[model samples]
Target: MHLFADMLARVHAAAAAVLGPSADLTRIVVEPPRDPSHGDMATNAAMVLAKDAGQKPRDLAEAIAAKLLADAKVEKVDIAGPGFINLTLKGEVWPDALRTVLEQGKGYGRGTVGAGKKVNVEYVSANPTGPLHVGHGRGAVFGDALASLLVAAGYSVTREYYINDAGAQVDVLARSAFLRYREALGEDIGEIPEGLYPGDYLKECGAELAADYGDRLKAMPEAEWLPIVRLRATDMMMAEIRNDLARLRIVPEVFFSERSLIEGELPDPFSKEPPKPLVDVVAETIAALREAGHVYEGRLPPPKSGNLEDWEDREQTLFRSTEFGDDVDRPLLKSDGSYTYFATDIAYHKSKFDRGFADMIDVWGADHGGYVKRMQAAVKAVSGGKGQLDIKLVQLVRLLRNGEPVKMSKRAGDYITLREVVDEVGKDAVRFDMLYRKNDAVLDFDLAKVIEQSKDNPVFYVQYGHARGKSIFRTAAEQGVLPADPAALQRADLVRLTDSGELSIIRKLALYPRMLEAAALAHEPHRIAFYLYELASEFHAQWTRGGKESPHLRFIIQDDPQTTQARLALVQGIVTVLASGLDLLGVEAPEEMR
Candidate 1:
């Protein structure tokens, strides 16, 4: 059960009764008090509604407080500050909440806020030109965890990756691989040109091409040979990408190809080239927008600097993005008479809409921050206002050791690959450390600190919290005070858990479902990471206090077996919640630290 949600509902009911059914309760919120001494929870029903209800703020607060006095859960209600109503629930409620945690176990935080609504999350759509870098890794882990969070919140989510195979970058990759093929054919292609990729990763593709087709590809012209090599290189690169994602336990359900929107009539890796079909999605999409009066022929305003380097000022096909929230209209075609990247992307979003998804999320790199407004406008224009696009921008990551910057290995690639970081530290550390901050904030990943056993290392600290909880259960079992199995521990009377330290863990566990719901709704998976850190901190604090300050407060009270069972039960509840939250973030919760 969501304790805060229950209190929020109760507060709303009390507000409705006091205001005689006309009060605006939309802004009313029941949250924890800033000072725990003030109360367990607080609400602002009077301050937000008093002006509309024709009463003084304090008077309205008193009336609502009086109404709330009848609630069984709320033990005390005080009118603090100008109008705040702080509530202290009966102490037994905390134990009951913990009992619910034990009853639910791994499913403790599961919620139904989404009601099984379909949500399409497109992320890590990095081009298949090379291995995914750490920058791409941020979006990959963020999107994968966001998908998991939505599923826990009862949303039917589709994890998708849009393959940018139709872009020019892949063409450059094909050319780079072709150069490597020449080298494989005993030709010294001196220092790779500025326009092509120089990564040694492509040598394998070149070797495979040389073995498969021998000189057959070389016999054809660039126009014919490039397509076959492009397809082959893209296929191999995507396979490598899938293996990388698998290393981190991310397997996207859909790998949608941007090239598929257009007919891949270039050539098959084997057999003769398929004939080009009479389909151009880009043209069809532009025509559809033109029919809807959203597309037009216009020239964009000059750059803000007013700089023009042999720029042609001719009219081109434009989308009236200004009609939406965009700052200016955007072009659909370039000067070379080919579709712009935005054009094919508009088609991709249209395909998603056609597949029956109205709620869409696009996870992109920070460099694409400026693209949000235009893409949102495009979705509005294409989906006819039925589709909503929320783009999450992930900022850059700086790899460092201690305080100094960490350099990439020159042998791997031009930049640090996600696989390198994941391989250096295990996948759990890579994922959790990345998500420890908000998605938009620039991240500093320190290689030396994440594995440390101190409080500074969040992944280690949280996992230690889970491990320590089990350690307590083991200590209790040695005293013959509790059962060895967790299921057996659940039968311990939770009401015996009356210590302040014990109830503190219970309150923290009760907040997990609420955190999951908020994180899922806000599309920020980082909140789960932050909440786990706080929960672990609380557990560690209480554990240290028990050992150092008071022996009676410890879990294994030999004289009072009842209290020992209860404390062990609370530990089980803590471990259960930490494990559940960690799983949502694709992290590991170890039972033994060693």
Candidate 2:
């Protein structure tokens, strides 16, 4: 069903016949002609291979064209200026392409580009200290959509969430909750400390603790009560986060805790009978890197950016990150002998490799942009170049209401929660708007605009396309257009779909499989959103044109049952693709807009 891919394979075969088997066909691409008058599809096989073929580009193009014309599907092959070969397929090909869409239905665009490769996508790994904010929503939607896209492209994807629970931030969360706990016990705790969390969300956690353990936790010292409170507060916050993620319909398969990397001991993998002494993964990672000459005792120069508070003119345990393309050798341990964040991160990624994942993707917030290179370097060191780490940094989401900045949440105090946005505008609007732009680019999410049922609102426009398609089928059945069933519709005379507007819809449908494969390969789910909008615009325009034009151009023709059925098949094709694309983006394709 990938028309471009199929044509590209034929083009490659023609090139091999002319230039012989040793020719490199990797650079050649088959794509739709930019100018419709040029041809249906265009290829640059001759231009790319001319120099190595010892021939003029035009001469090579002519030879390739001759070979291509021999194929039954190719009606004409024209060599353009300097040797870009444009192909025009037979008239029947478009109807056959439409047939492919009708027959395949929901399976139309499923591709094998990934070839079942195992890929681990870790996204929305927000700290469990608080509720997820709008910024985290962008990462969540991007990561989840990318995972779904990869799955559609035939990749075995594992959705993961790395919980950042082993930091000083959680301690602050516990202290904040303890204050609220004291308040729960009818004690006056005035003014939250400046360093502690200020969000009112922790009040519920405080109330929960008070309900469970009463004043028992109040009697213990900070050392004794801190662990209990931290554990309880982190669990409560994480539960809230899970609830919020559910609001967005996102469920990550694994929630890997960062604390587990350093706190727990793993049984030696090499030992059998009675297991050897449990090994610390963080320490083991350091030792492995040391043995591999990737770790060393070194002193680092002052940083080129940010504060030098952590920098010292003393020897420290360091990873030779610069050797693997980092900006500098990274410290593995703090001055107090505890492992640094980078060290624990190295162990965590190493654990991913140990768990049969050689391909790892981490979806990070904009603030972690600078952390990419060192983490990539660590993956290389730990996996010994056998692993690949692709880090996608999702930029900030600027929330607005009718072009003005939106206010912060009362619950979160300083930021708006993801749950608030989802609840207000619905997850479909939040997700589609978030992914309608590229991940690396800053996205402006307008609250008032998203809910507007206008073409300007992409979420509504695209969903309406599906809704409109279903409406066409309903109208057809009411008008008593015979052969409304899918099987009979598939048998409709599709060659009657010779109108330019009808063919345009089929062409766009033909591009879905190719566009999906490209989007999956590029790790950009926004491409799907963009394609959906264009497809919807095309469908809407054609429908409007039919309304204004003669009755024969309409989707439901009263006198001509054949054309109506063919048009019905086209609508079915559009609905199938719209639903499939929406599913990949984690949005719903409704039968009706209301």
Candidate 3:
């Protein structure tokens, strides 16, 4: 249903006919003009086709433009800048787009980019040791928005959070909570001993422990009480984390615990199959790979920089990740016989493949960049080359307030919590600001800028656009010019919306479907955020243009109810698109933000 896709199809058919069995139109690309003055759309078909056709680029562009000009959709075609064919479509197509936008409402941008395939998006798999900091916030927002974008583009997506509760980090968290529990029992516990978590957030876990067990736990030894305290404390921390995620409007469909991967029974509980815990799954996977000649016993070199006085050379179980494109073979097991984190991760992904999700995406921080290739190798080897893994690395977020950096140190227990930021600037500001920049680019989130209710800020700019459309509907109602029913608005004589300002707004509305498909296919939600800003800017400019030019161009018309209803229909389309785009980014499209 995308107008651009339809136009491109027509161009492709015509180009194929002209070339007559000699040309491949797969390389032809149609894109919006970088400069609006160029045209509504531009294509590099001629430039791309000329090299193979043995003709000069300009000569080929002229020929393509001649063929396209005969089409009913093409109002005008111009050959520009060597070989680009710029096309201006007829104005009649725009009102139909407006009607479509209004009819579909929030579903206007939905598309079939994923073709009903099942994809698993694993993100925000933070350790249950502590609260998510600003760094985690970046991945959380990017992953959640990317999942939503995939769903909009027709993928059956499973949003997953892999909890790292099986690692040494949880042990530290348990010990930290144990200290707090003792302190809660009125024991004179000295200064939060070194190498333990020092965050005040664990204070509540301590209080909960006291409420559950009173002073009875104080008499128990470390080994006796540690497991009970750890389980309860970890559960409490996870609950707090869930609450924090709720504040940011992020909800993962599956909270897959790393501990559960090893502790739980196998999928076929009644079958003779052995209980495949995460660790056992990894061991079995490695054994199977060895049988297939993909796993080998190997020795790893010492670290490049650190002192290796304690480093002992020994053969270890290794995955031949280099054969599948990793830089080197990866160690599946450490020298201590315990499975490395990567080993468990391989089993985790194999589980995803076993469950029939061949397409997988993992959203990780930039620090995890080194891990991507090895993970992809594991997915390929385990799935027998049937499954694919796409890892999106989200760069860091620099938190700022009033142009000054917000300094934080996790080691010092002074890191800014995601919940605190959500509370301070509100969820809409946090989500939009986090997604305003590309995921791989460092984002500068200025608290003051996000909360500002002005055009200078994108969140406010888009929200104001939706609110302005609502304001017009309210004004039309007050003037007794509002449509009596949805059908009345649908039957609007949209031809009256022929003014250049109105037509430009309608053109922007027409771009939503195509933009959604592009963003979803690229796995980039920032594109939606950027598109909403541009759409809002166009609507605002059109509204402001009417103020300076014809006052009759205003949305409300006291004496002309037909024209007023038509403009109101256009306004409704704009609001629907703005709200829909914001919804994908997890931002609020407020009716009135004042």
TM-score of each: 0.95, 0.95, 0.91
Candidate 2 lDDT tens digits, 124-151 = 9888988898999999999999999999
lDDT of 3 by residue, 508-548 (tens): 88888888888888889999989999989988887887685
What RMSD value applies to candidate 1? 2.2
lDDT of each residue in 1-594, candidate 1, tens digit only: 568888888999999998878777989877777798998888989999999988999999999999999999989989998999999899878877877888888888899988999999999999999988888888999999999999999999999999999868999999999999988988889999998988888999999999988888888888888888999999999999999998888999999988877765464657765666647777788899999999999888876766787345889989999998998888888899888888999989998998988999999999998889999999998899999999999999998888788776664556778888888888898899999989999999987887788999999999999999888877777767768576876778788877777777788888788879888989989999999999999998887877867888877888988878888888888888899989999998888998
Deviation of model 2 at 1, angstroms: 4.1
Ranking by lDDT: 2, 1, 3
* Residue 53 in candidate 3, Cα distance off native in Å: 7.2
Candidate 2 minimal-lDDT segment of 10 residues: 264-273
Better candidate number, 1 or 3, judged by lDDT: 1
